[model samples]
Target: MELLPTTIVAGPSLLTRASALDQVVGKLRAGKVYRREDLAYVSNAVDRHLREMVSGGALKRLAQGLYYAPKKSVYGTLPPDDQELLATFLRDKDFLVFSLSSYNTLGLGTSQLYNKTLVYNHKRHGIFSFGNRQFDCRVKPRFPKTLTPEFLLVDMVNNLDELAEDRNLVLQMVVRKLPGFDQAKLKRAVSNYGSAATRKSFARWQDG
Candidate 1:
């Protein structure tokens, strides 16, 4: 019976891991969203810290590698801020988030509403689910920092057929409404932001 020396490999202690978790959680902005990399500056063991936090009810896992500290309400946990999540996902502050429902504001003979939100950016393109909402990331060559009425109008026309309302009637109404917009700005938007088909469509309306 021989007992060789028992070897214990020393790694970070549970206390150290707990401290890393605390540091990571403490640095997160409540009601805001974060990604694993966003918290990497605080702890290299981010995945473990996040997993423990989620298990402890200190954080909510929104999606793969996405998390929120949550804002409490009598109703339930409020969803993470979409703007911050999208910003983190894209890793750039240069993107536009607009509700597809804004198309209803065009007064194009339909108050039809949609549940999806549009994310305009050059970095990513796809449909993603965030919290309780659906976000459609559209990659564009150029997009304005802030949406303008002229841009909305052009975008509505560009996506007209996809809308639920009477496409022809909405198209006709929008064509008529075009006359009411500032001619210069409308033309510029069509030229810069509008697709080739959109430009052709606008030209047809302008001529007739």
Candidate 2:
């Protein structure tokens, strides 16, 4: 007589899956962002646990493979920190974040208030939104670790077309303001960060 073959089971059983999910959830800290792979070691079924937690509001998916653990305050749940989100998304700490309102500090008479936030990073390019917040990420070949007066001026000209000011008036002000900035540092910033059009324009400003 032929003996019957025993069937083999493939993945974790429901009880084991539940235990793994419990372990994964136990590791969460509020107001922190996580990459999917970050919790993989804690769960045999990380994707399933993530899906279940997302469905149950234990996690908020910020992007593909990205999640946020919301923190509660007296008012309501707080959104993930911008720095933390960018750090997780880019997987790099080399980035510069600033608002368009920073142009006003340049003293070129630009006072427009903008709600937009710009992120200069070497890794990603495009707009990403988290809840009510939006980050406009631009991939730059080179950017300063910190914002500088000279870098801001070059950046302002590079993005002049996008600003809400009169282009000609701003150009005039920029030309006049050139004399006010450190000639050497401003030239270096323009050489390093300026767009072709900005470089040409600054060349004329410097020559004249």
Candidate 3:
């Protein structure tokens, strides 16, 4: 049997790993979602540390390989923030996180606010749960890193059918507001982000 070098598996290296893990754990902001790999660089025994952390109630596993060091309040342990959770799940901060209810604010006659949220990400697609809330994750060809009014206007028209609103009234309002939008940006959104059906519906307005 070959004996490994003493320096290769020294106590100092183990201590350093432990120290790094402890530092990262101590600094983990409450209500922030994290992946196991997010802290793997901190320690070689990261999985062990994570299991222990979960057992000790120091962290909550939100999903497969997803976790958060919770925030306690008078009501209960507060869930991770929506944007923070989405960023961890999608592994990209460049994605857009928005409540579908935001479309209501476009003044397209959508008065009923939706409880749903959506994620426009290049990495993931589907519905995912975080605590009690669910995010409808979608993959898109071209989505702006941030939300824009022009994008919202286009998106509102694009997703018009899916919304729980009066379609005819909303369409009337959309038509009325169409000319007020930033022409260049709206055109790009319709061509890029809008679905085929949406683009077809929007084409009539563009032609007028």
Candidates ranked by TM-score = 1, 2, 3
**TM-score for every candidate vs. truth?**
0.87, 0.86, 0.78
Off by over 4 Å in 1: 1-12, 73-75
Instruction: Sum up the clashes in candidate 1.
Output: 0
Backbone Cα, N, C clashes tallied per candidate: 0, 0, 0
Top lDDT prediction, candidate number: 2
Better of 1 and 2 by TM-score: 1
lDDT of 3 by residue, 1-208 (tens): 9998676555887787668667767867788788988778765678888887888788898888999999999999988887788877877787888876887777666778787788888888898886677889888767887888778877887777788777898888888988888888888888878888888878987798
Q: How high is the lDDT of residue 46 in model 1?
A: 75
Q: What's the CA error at residue 48 for candidate 3, in Å?
A: 3.9
Assess the local accuracy of residue 190 in candidate 2 as a C-alpha lDDT between 0 and 100.
Answer: 93
Residue-level lDDT for 141 in candidate 2 = 96
lDDT of each: 0.83, 0.91, 0.81
Cα-based lDDT at residue 20, candidate 2: 74
lDDT of 2 by residue, 93-123 (tens): 9999999889899999999999999999999
Tens-place lDDT digits, model 1, residues 44-106: 787777888889878888788888888888998777776778888888889989876887776
